[model samples]
Target chain A: MNVPLLNVSGATRRFGGLVAVNEVSFEIGPGQVCGLIGPNGAGKSTMFDLITGVRPLSSGSIHFMGRDVTQEPAHSRSPMGMSRTFQIVRLFPGMSVLENVLMGFQPKFPDGVIRSLFGIGRLGGQERDARQRAYEILDFVGLADRAGDRIDELTLGQLRLVDIGRAMAASPRFLMLDEPAAGLNDAETNNLAEMLARLKADGLSMLLVEHDIDFIMNACDKIVVMDRGTKIADDIPARVRTNDAVIAAYIGKRAHDAQH
Target chain B: MPLATKRASVWPVVAVLALGVALPFLLSGGFQLRIAMLIWIFAILSMGFNLLYGYTGQISMGQQGFYAVGAYAFALLQIKLGLSPVLAFAGAVAICAVLGLIVAYPLLRLRTHYLAMATLGFGLILNGVANRWIDFTGGTAGLTVPPLTWGGEALGRTGIYYVVLAIAGVVFLLHDFIARSHVGRALQAIRDDETAAAALGVPVRRYKLRIFVLAAAIAAVAGCCFSVVSLRVDPSLGEFHILVSMLTIAVVGGLGTRFGPLIGAAIVTILPQLLLQFGAAETLIYGAFIVLFLLFIPHGLAGLVENVRWTRKSAAPARTAATNVLEVKG
Candidate 1:
């Protein structure tokens, strides 16, 4: 009954002659928490890159909120309510944690150099608003207390949350997280799952790419399994778990496994 | 209390500016004033370098090329065209900024060490041009400018010192503002993680080119001032002499920290003259000090200050566990 928030049709990426992602198609509806699971070299991260404008698609159509954004630059797409985090945490190590989040708010600031320099007109107000929002996002992610600390001081798990807070600071309608639970412990993983659920409740759409099966199973409403850059299965979690292609892809019983 | 903190951060700058104003009187010699003026000029150049290298994380070896362009631009305008010093300085800055945009377009594409090498090659080309263009640059012999004067009075060594001091103060304030502004944050983001910053919607290449041009323009301003003070400009200004490009004043003082370049400039500029006071062994001692500084304190004196702050803060926790526990509980 709801319009899809993100629509990817016949997305194909080729690195030289080798096809990395081949005609993959999927749709993510509004407020949907979708899971994308694939083994190493399954082109999941590359797909995130393509969707976020980090990599130019060889051939594809990516529509966000019914608008074609296939050729938009990363910065432009960010303000259109699309934001993503890296597989490896990429906080500004030299800057304070709050400032790292503030970096994500770059798009909301006045783009005029004169306004930025003179701190006049709309820019000053935007800066104050951005700072307030950054702090609030940090608070939401339970990182308000650590805002003043340098990013390098935080542990890997804390840094992951900081990365999420940074994406949230952009006020994105859809958040793409790549391996958000990659380096976290059990307790931290559980906390992250809870946080993702809370964010979903707040009407935020999420595309989660993670290796932790249990975490994904608990958090995602629907699952899209990728194997060798192809969509192996797409269904609700209960149906996807019993799908043969998904099973073979995860358990290494596929013809594609022999080529590697 | 926050205002008090802000005031505390500002006082050091006020004190340093005051010291700069009083330096000529304290030294009281023509040679000393000359050396001080050179230090101030180089300090400005180092600050420009700091913006590109320290803050933006772009290693630029072509700064010397820009410096020569500025120096020659100022020199020719003053000597041949008989332009006023202020007009010549402005023309020099304008030309350098244009050159910066031209060079940065291609050079910004080169990554890391390759970028450094590309800029180095560009510097060499500029140096060669200066040497070969005999009529304009005076070849290896160089060109000279008439002494700078204001209000129908020639600026003596002491007067030049004050002028240099004033220029340095303005440049320092400009640098401070740029460093604290959104532009500074964007530059730092580009340095920290270019891909991530780009993903967050930073116009990485545009910001990089902007800073590159800004740095060049600032260097041109400094170069113009240096040419006027020395009354001479040479092809050596563009020579790409590794040491001149590697003048680690910013690194030796503190990269990315305000006033660090001045400290670096003072050490590099003043040390040789002080060594001159000691006769021929000065060069040997100078080289040794540089080697030692590079090896032992790579972060420069600024790092040492940071180290001291770190130790003091680290030590406080050990001595006040009870207070810390109470605060944590509260």
Candidate 2:
């Protein structure tokens, strides 16, 4: 009965003549673990991009904590407690692992040119606090020992965790992860599930987009099924498991392909 | 740990400053002192260019425009208005900062080659104005600036050298501080991956504009120093002659490192004079040397030093890995 922490109403995006996303509406309450499951080319990633301001929506609105933020830029959205991880694991390769997390603390610091020049005021204290917090987040993500290592030296699974840690450093109320478990092995995927559960218990709202059905089935409380840019079902996992439309659109093809 | 890092940095700067301050005394000759003064002036120019291209990843070919503006501002203040040289120099740098801010809004939006060409155009326009506006700028004949004086005594070559060294020291400290600060880290993030930096809440456009203005102001200071030491300002200061903007001391020594520009300026300034012993062949030899350096060492001497350190550190791990792989093969 509480107002959702994040609300998307009639959100739509188009590229040229093709409709990438069509009036998709969803809500995520605080501490909710929501999964966005879809077949290939179902526009899930595009929807995440639209919500995160990486790509502008053609129409509709996104609201976070009762404030309309449809027109806000990505950087402005971060201070409002919205953060996202990339599908391709984009990071500052030349920077140290600790510095990668420190980058996420940028919005928290007062970035005034004059204050920076004079080295006066609260910026000095804020910078010191931000660095300390970054180290703590690096520790939380289990990369404390590798904090001084360059990002390029990290493995794919480790890089994914770093990306998640970087987002966590922003201390977001809502985190949208784009395929966090895509290339992770069984053990790594289990570790990620544990991390996500811990984050959810801490009252973080998460929209997880993943192709790993078993991981999502275990981790997510609710599932939203999409096929060909339209939501086919939204319900608790038990109901979603037996939904005819979801079965027809996703499970049916997956089962049929598995037989061969 | 922070104090240790600070001490490590401080010692080198102190040593360099002492060397620079004692140079004129050690030489005692007028011509050599004048050349030393010139080296310091160019070092300032190269340091400014490093902030733009090396730190901020913005290709700027219009540094000469700001440089010329400072020179002309000082010339007008001292020559036509008969103002004091010290105050005029300060006024010139301030005026250049204002002009830089105005220019940055439109030009900083351009990227890579377009930005370079746009700045190149700006320099050409300033050159044209200086040449055509004969009454104000002295046209192609050039304008003479009165020598800076302290208490009715003109600053001789030694005095000028010391003055330049002092300015260079301040600029170097300022550069070092900015390069290590939050803004510098943000700029580096932007340079490495702007999209990622933006996602993390870095104001990309604003930081770019800030660097552009800062670089312009630094170049303006260098120009003022040049005018004072040489006692002249010319339209050719705005002209892109001798590949002067491209041969910036920062690029020749190392792009992003703090001390690279000073080392680069020293080499570029002294090498040409040294090569002059070969008479007319000196110009040919100088061009050939520059070509070789650019072709073989794109990152320059500072990059070479970094490469050496990296290789030494990486060798032990590499050797161990080779041996382990051979054992596995057996």
Candidate 3:
């Protein structure tokens, strides 16, 4: 569909003798929110790592936006419109909220690099624009007033939102989120879901790896389920809800009975 | 440092620079100027070292390795190649830049303590070469550097002191700019959370390598300045003692603070001489001061002055902000 924004073919990763992700393949189209869900130890995070170029795949290939990027480094991929947030909150400490987000914009090093190297180029032209845009992003992330506050002062849920803000800062065509709602409470989770929906409506593509089945079911256009490192189900929400294999593998017979 | 908090520490920096400029006139004695020059030289060294460890979160305890290489390059260039002091110092810095580049790829492949140890080992190896490579380095006997000439007359103590002061100013400006710019934030991000930084697109390895090389070159600049002042280069320059001293200056000054190196250099350089009258008590008092500073003012001397400091952001927000978004939306 429109040259699938992300095409992963036979993505596999093995740790020593342990195959963390085995021959997993999937595609996400433009403006689609694809959820990757599975039980613990199912290699959801590992799969995120491979797709984002944080870790090299043991085998297979990944293509993004119409080019093979299986060997591209994370730093390079970021400039090419790939962005991600960690399962763990990974903001730079000791910086202001705006500073962390400002990092999302590099102003293209070559723009005034000589002065930057000499310590004279304060990025006078581009920096003002960067800061203005960073402020706007801070406003969007719901931390407009907290922009000047030190990052360490924020709450856990706010930190997750900051991660989202930071990911958005890059203006990425593809965003990979690793358990964005893992530590979020009910209200925070709802806020996150709404944000995802809004991003999708804006035509941004996203890959969300999460454990909250309800949130995944609600937000994703399609869901990919894995257990024991193998992808077992890939389907739209309605069909997957009643599929016998999907129900048994994910919900389990006893849990399914309890739900019914 | 965040945007607002970074603005808070400006006064101390201004005061330091003003005092640095006025230092020569205030102290008329060559001996005292020598000590002041020493302070300035170490301050430059601290600035470089801090760029690697403080801002970038990469540790290199063997900075003396680069420093010694620069010194030797400075001396050998003038002696063997007949290059002028300016050209020789320039040559030395160039050599250091290349050396830093060559070493960074392999050395920076390591992280944390392993990187520290590798750098420490690098320093020791260079120390050995400087000591044993007698034909080139003059062994422990050292190489005597000719005084830099201005209008064919030796610049003398005062002139050289200002030279050192000028170089220190330039280095400080460079260091400060890096701290304030987007590049500075990137370095801090890499230090705070490297994986995330890479995901955010900070060329982590390249940035790490750049700082490492920048640090090496700055150390070389300090080395050339030392040769002009002391006019000597020996194995002791690259020894473990020197590395530890440089580290103390950076740590006690402040690892990542604006005025840390300068403030730290002034105190660490002045404190020992202040106690020299006590003879044996000098070492004891100096050690005690370092321990006390490290124990009490853990954020360093700069940190002690600035009350509102930046804290690295973590992934989790405070629980209080859980419904914070809803409120904002409402």
lDDT of each: 0.79, 0.77, 0.81
Choose the strongest candidate by lDDT: 3
Candidate 3 residue-wise lDDT at B156: 82
Cα RMSD for candidates in order: 7.5, 7.2, 5.8
Could you give the CAPRI-style class of model 1? Answer: acceptable
Real A-B contacts recovered, model 3? 0.65
Better of 1 and 2 by lDDT: 1
Clash pairs, candidate 2, are none
Query: Using alpha carbons, what is the TM-score of model 3?
Result: 0.91
- From the highest lDDT down, the ranking of the candidates is 3, 1, 2
* B147 Cα displacement, candidate 1 (Å): 2.5
| Model 2: CA > 4 A from native | A120-129, A251-260, B1-11, B81-83, B242-248, B304-330
Tell me, per candidate, how large a share of the native contacts it keeps. Answer: 0.44, 0.39, 0.65
Candidate 2 C-alpha lDDT tens digits along A1-260: 37888888988888888888888898888888899988888888888888888778899999899999999987787778888887777776545677778788877665845667675466567667877787788778788777767666788889988999988888898898999999888888888899889898888888999999888888888888877777778888888888777777775656334323
Candidate 3: regions farther than 4 A off: A107-115, A118-122, A253-260, B1-19, B310-330
Model 2 DockQ, alpha carbons vs. true complex: 0.28
Q: TM-scores of all models? A: 0.89, 0.87, 0.91
lDDT of 2 by residue, B148-212 (tens): 78779997777777788888898887776666566666776766666667778887888888888
What class would a CAPRI assessor give candidate 2's docking? acceptable
Kindly report the TM-score of the first chain in candidate 3.
0.92
lDDT of 2: 0.77
- Model 2 alpha-carbon miss at residue B196, Å: 0.5
